[model samples]
Target: MKKEFRSGCPISSTLDVIGDKWSLLIIRDMLIKHKKTFKEISDSDESIAPSILSARLKLLESYKLISKIKIPKNKKENIYLLTEKGIRLTPIIIEFSLWGDTNMREFNKIKDVKGLNLDKSYIIQSVQDHYNSMLLNF
Candidate 1:
């Protein structure tokens, strides 16, 4: 579907899709936290409402950032995974993590991104590699 954009600016266009907090959090759960199921994502620290969660998941799927599927044996359950396009947001998530780690500490307690001991590129690559491994197994 062609989406209506408020402006042609890159950042604005990107935000038009993932601008909402729930959408970004949903992506975070899939990418960094490895939460694939509806229950798992809804049970996130943010405690998103079921209705909102369902809507955001559908929106993300519509944007081709994520994909939903059901296992052959369990047609009743749905598993959502980040597509390659979605995986591209890994670096953005990491950037947010790093920014929060540096600037948000005085206001709130936020954990550093996993593998803080390594370089930023390594952390991003490790996350992408882990997700790819899971995809391969699935």
Candidate 2:
């Protein structure tokens, strides 16, 4: 089923492409931790069902947000990685995590989001600056 979005805002449009509960988390797993295998992502706390994980990975690939590359030693297995577009979303995810940290008490235990002690804007800028530095070095 196609997800219905609230509006045509650019952010909303982007979210429409990936706003589902699972997609962002999958992307987050890749962007932050570099998780890159079907098995690794399937084992996340979301504990996504294999069918759903397969479907979501296909959708993300069709949209060009991620690419599945063959693992060097074993060409049979694929490693998922973010495209430039996918890496660019790190700030938005960081911002959402910051908001959740301050306002949504239940999710603090989530990995990587903790220990930063970062404020909303700080995290956003930090992600942006991190991406910027990456671009410079690349």
Candidate 3:
């Protein structure tokens, strides 16, 4: 579906495409946690409803952020992978992690967000590289 922006502002436009309760979480599942199947993503800690998961997956696909493929052996199962566009959001996700680790830890009960001591660039590249490697197996 073509996205309708609320304003011409870049941030607003970006939000139009991804600013939702569930969109980024879906992205996070695929990018950070390597969740590919519908069941895997739905079983996340957030416990997103199946209906909302379906809608967010479609929205992400409509924006070219993810691509879906059927398992070769099991045609009934699907694996959702992030596209280049979606992988580009890795840095943003990393930033959010850092922000939450630093600021929201107390209220959120986050004991620690791993790799806080490591270089941000290294972490980002590692995540993107992992995704790229996964692509080669398909």
Candidate 4:
């Protein structure tokens, strides 16, 4: 069984849903690159197993972070899409990607992002604004 999340703090609650390394990576794959199908997710260089990816998708869906829909062209296969909650994570994911590109020898692309001195406050505000826009559009 999955561990229960702490409820009082919103940050804690947010982490409870996606604190795991895989979950965030999955979210990154979806939000950053707009990967939709299970095949695309499984094909990630991260090499996540299908079963683990399935479980993570289920968990994110349960938390209302993402949803799946059948593609009109290929109705048999489902494409996972981020809900408002998932879209709200955009800036944070970008920041983490920026951090990884800077510190990790493997991720060198962030030199530009770091050089730009991406504003953390601006990212946070963007996320809030994006979520607000999503909610209102509904």
Q: How do the residues 79-133 of candidate 2 rate in per-residue lDDT, one tens digit apiece? A: 8877888887777787777777667777446555553585656766666565546
TM-score of each: 0.94, 0.75, 0.94, 0.73
Q: Which has the higher lDDT value, candidate number 1 or candidate number 2?
A: 1
Q: Candidate 4 clashing pairs? A: none
Q: For model 1, how does the per-residue alpha-carbon lDDT over 39-126 read when each residue is reduced to its tens digit?
A: 9999988889999999899889999999999967899999999999999998898888887887898999775555765799999999
Query: How well is each residue in 1-138 modelled by candidate 4, as lDDT tens digits?
Result: 375877878799878889887999998787655677899988887899989999999999988889888888887999888888788787778778666766784644333443325577776675556545644653
> lDDT scores for all predictions?
0.89, 0.77, 0.90, 0.77
Best by TM-score: 3
Ranking by TM-score: 3, 1, 2, 4
Clashes of 4: 0
lDDT at position 131, candidate 4:
48
- The lDDT, on a scale of 0 to 1, for candidate 3 is 0.90
Worst 10 residues of 1 by lDDT: 109-118
Tens digits of per-residue lDDT, candidate 3, 1-138, equal 777889999999889888898888889889988899999999988899999999889989988999999988999999899999999999989888888888897887786757877999999999999888888976
